[model samples]
Target chain A: MKFLCTRCDEVMKLAGAQAGDDTVGLTFSCPKCGGSFAMLTNPAETTLVKGLGVQVGGRSEPAPLMEVIQSSVARDTENQITWDPGAETRLANVPPFARPMARKAIERFAESKGIRTITAAVMDEARALM
Target chain B: MRMYHEVAGDGGSDILGQVGKMMERLAGRLSLIKSVIAVASPKGGVGKSTVAAHLAASLARRGARVGALDADLYGSSLPRLLAPEFIGANATRGEEGLFPIAGVFGVRVMSLDYLTGYGARASVAWAGAGGSITRGPVEASALRELLADTQWGELDYLIVDTPPSVGRLGDLTALVPSLAGVVLVSAPTLLAYQVTLKSIERVRALGVPLLGLVENMRGFTCDLCGAANRINVEGEMGETLSIMGVPALGALPYDQRLLKPAGEAGPIEAVERIADALLAKIGGHAAARA
Candidate 1:
């Protein structure tokens, strides 16, 4: 199987069949960028896929959705507030390329603080941290 | 739904997808060599390239299929150093990749000099229009791709001649994470030793095994009387090596015979000794597998 580094764009070839099982995870270091990433056996023969097992920097944390649900529901039982108009406006200011990561970070922050309704102030604090 | 739902719900962005594709490409490139050795120094003009060429030649002479990769992009010297004796017949191209030009003693060679047609005059005039290659993300990417794209056939060893800098050392380590070892070259001068120590620290920080330090130009041999006089600050260099906790592989005296196109055999013997020490330090393919 082949893997390309996100940072340096250099291709690495690994013996995918060596992994054996379909669910096998292979950890490799990019010779070019020195970045470490994991790949799992792809269902299609001779292919591989990412995201099923990728843990950069060796840090493992709670799932993003789990963090949000626990933080938001723990404090306010009935707080189901959606994005405030002001918050949406601020989110629009985020670049399209980074919008997804920025938005997820903001949601996690709001859920942690028991803020079900995201306001401009929440976006302000999220923007600050990022 | 989460706040990021809309953004992520539209699948991932094109940029993220592109990054994923690139990462996959990096993972699939494989090396054919059994052991990869990098020869580096933090400062330039310490005979790092000379040491690399000789090491490659020494290994090849031993019937080991060795390949010398001149990683010094801007100021390449391998082609010039070995060109007289090791002629580049021609670089064959195919669907796989360009074949490395064969050098002296049947050692396969690859360098930017061959690509730019610069040969040994890379340091003097890399480009005709005063063009200079700047260091940055783009250049770094290009270097990485160049290394990955090379089609090196099966070999016993691949000696990489790295540029003088900590960054290039890091990049090489990243490119070949399973490096057999790093052989540092330095002259017996205060400045060169100081920078070499920094390189030692950088290599250690990267967790790459350092084979040992080679004190190049440790002394001068007089051709008239055939007397070898050790240069000054030898004791200080020993202290630096002690502080760094790396063994001194060998000390190569300054031999004027190396300046010629066809290098003399005497000085090259010193390089072979260092290569022997490095192989001993590697402890066979067991350490290489580790």
Candidate 2:
């Protein structure tokens, strides 16, 4: 696949998924003014899988965090949080503190990239459980 | 093989199983990029965002898949620095979410400013009341929401720009799993330098790696050769940095070319050289990955 750099208009071949995410580096310098620029060599958004974990059911479980991204998936994905509106009741059974953390984590999952808020929630939830 | 419903209608193990599946899917996306480095400083006017933008740009220039995210929720400066000229309210409107304004060079960019209608984080200040921004004390979830809403496509580096403070709070960065390091920007001013040290130690205490230190506006430069020597000054910036142990990335002598845009007028387009200098110190791939 070919990825066109938005900066230099340089067309570099997108190395295969197996080739590695570091292969495609950015080079942005305007040939005219020597104004160079660059961006990261992104990975195959569709084919790759990043690990995400969250505590659930009294045990820490791996959670699917930010998934389904494309050159197309922009910040708007938060609007589609897909919260099971009534899930609040199910969330009730969780401890008062874990409930909040769970709520926040779920909201984060619905809104941003994956697992951004887990470290804190996991700790807080672990503490609450204990 | 357990199927979970996206709707709240059902409960039981199905919910747990479904959540697991969902997290598994989301993890797939987060895995694409190994690190999201945020450069920050607590006191404003210390060039925190400037260091962040340039470092990110430099990394991108060096062949890394980088996404420059301005997370200084209240002080986002990347929108203007990266892609200015975008005046439409729906400028970031896209099927996915807010679209980062591509700069003179394309670095997949996004800022909280893009989500709310503004060029920087100031807009969100009024828009999101004290506790209503999203939910919880952890802002990373809101950041994640911002990330989920935007179309970042893909990036190797997501160099985040943050408010100079103690740390982050979302599921992604705010609550961080791990970090490559934290680039704390400071000046030679004792107060700034001390705070920078505190931030460095704090991040390390939290387990986040300290990439190194960047002393901005270290001193003045000679007019003729542009050498960064503190003119008529008693001590050098690097002299004090030695005892700190953290690698002094380099001292940015008050370069008019570099400081002008990031000053009262805000990020100017002529500071690419500053970006280059930062990238060089980041060590590129040559710096053995620990």
Candidate 3:
């Protein structure tokens, strides 16, 4: 079951059972922000979720509760570029429309650098430590 | 009530009920995962992560589906510390919870260190890590995310490594709504013990049970004389913890090899015998309760 909550930051669990035909909608109150929202989980295909950072009025605000909870457990914020003054960009936090672009950017960045997501230095450090 | 909630090893579901209720409205399901263990220290360099990592690994080695949360967002070391190739992996977001990065022997790891590209570290130096994603300021935020999205796959334990200072909530082990207990770690130094006691007091307010005390870097044996003296004069300082109503879990003597210039394979397992004994205690407690 895939879904997102803004206040919650990431995936919150789906409580109800999967019903027959077409789409499955599960609802829950976010454990993080204490807000309520519904999730659409299908046995088929991925569910593209809107991130918490993007607000309804087209302004960015705290996410729905479910997203925060999901983000916490699954570590949705693992990929992010943070700036010195204070701006951090994460693919998960990016708007749904931007995910593909973000993923591509990450892929290109990985390729151009001649290093995969896991860095050579970290791998080297691995040898030294082990 | 006998105020049973105040003590660790009490084995009552009171703590569970209390924390569970706090997160109740938020968690959509029964949350099959039981026992969220946070390893914390008010001071850094006390081997908090080292102990927590090994505990997770040891638990997994015993056949439990174990997951390790490298909660120290900005300055995590678990990725570099684990051996072979399962060193580190970042968490992936999902509706259920954060799917942990796989580590050696099937142990799952989640860390922000992996989130920022390895080069992100360089960028972070140029920029900043967007505040202390470390367990300090972001405990509440992180805990919520952990519970909701992590793909733990029915694990027995979730070992969280917290930064030295509690930060926002201060002592997160206590402040966080859900947790079985807190494991306090300290070096043999008197200063370490003093800090540990203070940290424990902070959590006492949250009423979290103190699992026990672990004294790391206790001593280095004199190979020639066999007169095992602690790493330094401050090493003999685990006494206050005993007086404070917290049981001494184990005393890990210092070994230079474990802390050699480059070696970092998990504090040498501390005292295997003590670990086995402690395991027995936990096992017996679980079985008796079961």
Candidate 4:
């Protein structure tokens, strides 16, 4: 998206930017007339830009791989499943690569059964189902 | 007063530059891989995923470092077929990026199922102000992120199993920097042949090499007699293949053993032959390019 300074009939350079709770303000200045203006983006527009995984004003550091997905996915706390010591020990036995997936499966199994806390029994039940 | 004029660049966002960086990351990661093959078919329920899973296993059985990427976001069945135990499992992150889970035959596997933790039945709905209208762009972004993020270490072959859509095939071609080739899958049906021909045209138009076609479920081999029973009027598909000038890699007969568990010796012999033919075709294609 480009900005044209109608008063000066010249292209506007991005001067600065500020990100708010649900909006983004981009300030631009005309090189010919030294005039400036601010463009504020709505929540939806801000989200669309965010989804592209790019920063408004160039990025200082390269964005990490899958940063957009990793940030947007549901957090573990949102699921509301806690694990007991025994279950945690069992989970530790899984290989590091598969551990996260195993943990998610166990928590999902426990949640489906209306169980708030995951124990060794729940882990076994999930294993049996698998 | 003069008239206003639009600028040439993105004003300063450099969204295009960022996207270029993303593609660079993907290319840098894929540089270590020797061949990137995509098993695609425009029509579904034709064993594209099955062929992909078995092909990866077969390639690995040949001692090649293989990685199977389940590009089917809507229905990622490669996880269930290759590593059922890893279903509902979340992808683990590392200092570099997300890790691809090691599945059967030591083939590295990555899919949206791992990232989303929704397993095989993930109903991926992208909500936006435009409702269902934004699904295409959303899906493209998700695929781009998946390709850019997963840390696939050194590999001999990375076989991508694409969903049953010509558009998805186009997306893969556009996303992957240097695709080795594409293996179009087709059943022994006239309908499949028609749609697959269109896919063949699309691939050619994109200038990606076609690695021949695998005729799956062409016939059934009788278990008791050890005799192959010919299914579908033979020569119909042959005529079509001849007309299209696409090589027939091999015909996979319908086997009951494939329905059995993964470890229990199911169709490896047939799949190995197909794998060999694919390698030879890829070699020839590379030679021709050279």
Candidate 5:
């Protein structure tokens, strides 16, 4: 089967597939743009390539790509949150991995007080609440 | 007929090997959005899209930046609900990324209707005829990219309107693990309520917060006699959801005025009422965040 690059319209063929196998790895550099794209195939292969072309920096080491990806996923399990400048500085006391959770806690604290902005005082209150 | 050739060995030979990396990349791209909320149902015709569109509009109205992401790949209705002009065209692209089309009240929107090249109107026709652009795991991954690739700017809220399908819900949860919450939309009918309960269970199993349940089209009002009566559906929906620990957001009565053309003004009053209650909870949660 063939898959099209959603960005450059470059077509890449799938490596031979075994019968009844629903999944397959498809990778190709779109000659048109010299950008790399990869995917595990499914019936809707076209949509999977949502205009993303991984810009390959100079290839030196075969990255433990999967490992890097796994670590990122594990980290993302914690919510990424926003913070006001004062509140963010206050979060310096919190651990890096725990900052996201702390941010959420602070926002909730602010919301309770009908506070839209998270100042240092709000952060102090949030820390107590948490 | 081949415009391009396949590389013999590049990247990973095992196609399934890239799923994790793909998901990781996607999550990284979408990290900027503050809150991700999905409006879902277990069955169709439950007014899920209407809820999502109006909720987003309401959020935008409250002086917060907002975006509406239509995740219904097969039957996208956000374009029509929010920005009808974008119905047959693709969202414009820029050097930064694909710009989400600004719709009514400045709400950014991204949908398959704006992404597919197959004339958005034509695609809807095909979807209505029981055709889909893709299926299975690929569909899930595609949705991840859709959300990741759109340049939503700094949004305070992103309302994801999803189709009523088990697989579609899986796709959303897989892509958005940090989702703030999910609002299950259902009619006041027993059948709709039961189906919504199953959806609530699935969302809970995934660990995404359940914001609440919204009873859409709750009761019909008589125009002539000004009489209000609950729809023939029988069930204590609020009590049912409350038993499961999910708050009832409030019911939106059916209104015939919604069927009339509103044009550029966005969704009807019914949807807006639900949106108002939802926003209050969101606001209250921040104040009462545990």
Candidate 6:
């Protein structure tokens, strides 16, 4: 997408970019008027752009293939929820293929209740809620 | 309001140039492989994945370097069908790209299942406005990422197991510019034949070469006496093939042995036959062009 500077009737150049938790801020400057403009993207737009497997500003080094997928998977596991041994055992009962989703669901449940650690009792409660 | 001059190379982000570079990388990766074929069907439960896995195995058994890609994001069964033990296994990532897991007969395999950490049941939710949205673009981009990023290296053949949908097939064809051809799989039922015809039309519409159709589950083969028995009523598949001007590659009788895990037994004779015919067709097409 091209950005046009209405004040100077000149095309804007991407000056810089900053990535946030769920948003991306892009700064552009008009060469003719020396006017600066900044645009922020929502989470969805950020994801859509990230899905393109490209960076906002040109990268210093070439990105490895499947970087987006690798980062996304890593991000999913970066949450700080801890699982008790009993809860871990219970999670083992879930099919290996579904364990990731089950863990995510349980963690989300725990976080909703402001619980940091997931225990067998918490697992049972989450199961009951499900 | 004054006239707006569309400046060239306005020193923007150049997102389109990056996408073009990505495509160039994809093309470079594909160039190492001689043939890239997709086994596709329009509807599910027609044994498309089975055909794809066995086809790769069959080709690999014949001393060909084969790579199998499970492009079925939602219903990726090739991982289990090709390497059951590797199910839920994480893909090995190197500094350059992700490496495909070695399956039966040394056929390298890659699937989204490995990345998702959930085998086939993984729900691929996309981030959209306020909630999840339809996943057409996401799926396509994922496939493009897979095709562009996987360290497939050099191979004689790369068999892609496409999802049971024409849209996915189109996405794959568009993603891989070096696609050798496509093999459509269908069962012996009327519904399967109807859907297969639609897939054939879609393939032709995309202008990609249609290798042929494999009539999977044509009948059941009795293990005791080795007698082939017709399971479903034969439909107008033969007529449809003639009308569509597509060749009858081979008929794969439903064998219970295929249900057995990979490496327990080799690909059935019918699968081998399909593989041979596929090679011949691809060779013939290339020769004709040359």
Q: Quantify all predictions' global Cα lDDT against the true fold.
A: 0.61, 0.50, 0.52, 0.77, 0.62, 0.77
Which residue pairs show collisions in model 4?
Answer: A101-B89, A101-B90
Q: Report clash pairs, candidate 6.
A: none
Off by over 4 Å in 4: A8-48, A70-130, B1-9, B224-227, B232-235, B260-267
On residues B151-205, what C-alpha lDDT tens digit does candidate 4 reach at each position? 8889999999999976678888888747888888888887887788777788788
lDDT of 2 by residue, B1-290 (tens): 12233223232123456445544444544566666676767567888777776666555655677777777766677766554543222222443344555553456667655444222323453212223322232244445544545556676667778765765522344334544556767776767766666666666666655666677776775889977675334335465556766666655667665633223343333334544544554455226554
Q: List where candidate 6 sits over 4 angstroms from the true fold.
A: A31-33, A71-130, B1-5, B119-123, B127-134, B223-227
Which scores greater on DockQ, model 2 or model 6?
6
TM-scores of chain A across the candidates, in order, are: 0.37, 0.23, 0.23, 0.54, 0.34, 0.54
Using all chains and alpha carbons, the TM-scores for the candidates as numbered come to 0.60, 0.54, 0.58, 0.83, 0.62, 0.82
Top DockQ model? 4
Lowest lDDT sum, 10 consecutive residues, model 1 chain B, at B125-134
Q: Could you tell me the lDDT of residue B164 within candidate 2?
A: 58
Off by over 4 Å in 2: A1-130, B1-26, B62-64, B87-98, B119-122, B126-138, B169-178, B222-241, B259-290
Q: For model 5 chain B, give the 10-residue run with minimal summed lDDT.
A: B124-133
Q: A59, model 3: CA deviation in Å?
A: 13
Residue B219, candidate 3: Cα error in Å is: 1.0
Clashes of each: 25, 63, 47, 2, 6, 0
Q: What's the lDDT for candidate 3?
A: 0.52
lDDT of 4 by residue, A7-116 (tens): 76687899999988757899999999999989898866765666667789888789976766654444445544666788767776778766767887777778789887
- The TM-score leader among the candidates is 4
Order the candidates by lDDT, highest first. 4, 6, 5, 1, 3, 2
By DockQ, the candidates rank as 4, 6, 3, 5, 2, 1
- The C-alpha interface RMSD of every prediction is 27.0, 19.6, 17.3, 3.6, 15.9, 6.4
Question: If both were scored by DockQ, which would come out higher, candidate 1 or candidate 5?
Answer: 5
lDDT of 5: 0.62
What digit string (tens of lDDT, one per residue) describes model 6 on residues B190-256? 8888777876777888878999998888888677998878888657678769877999899888778
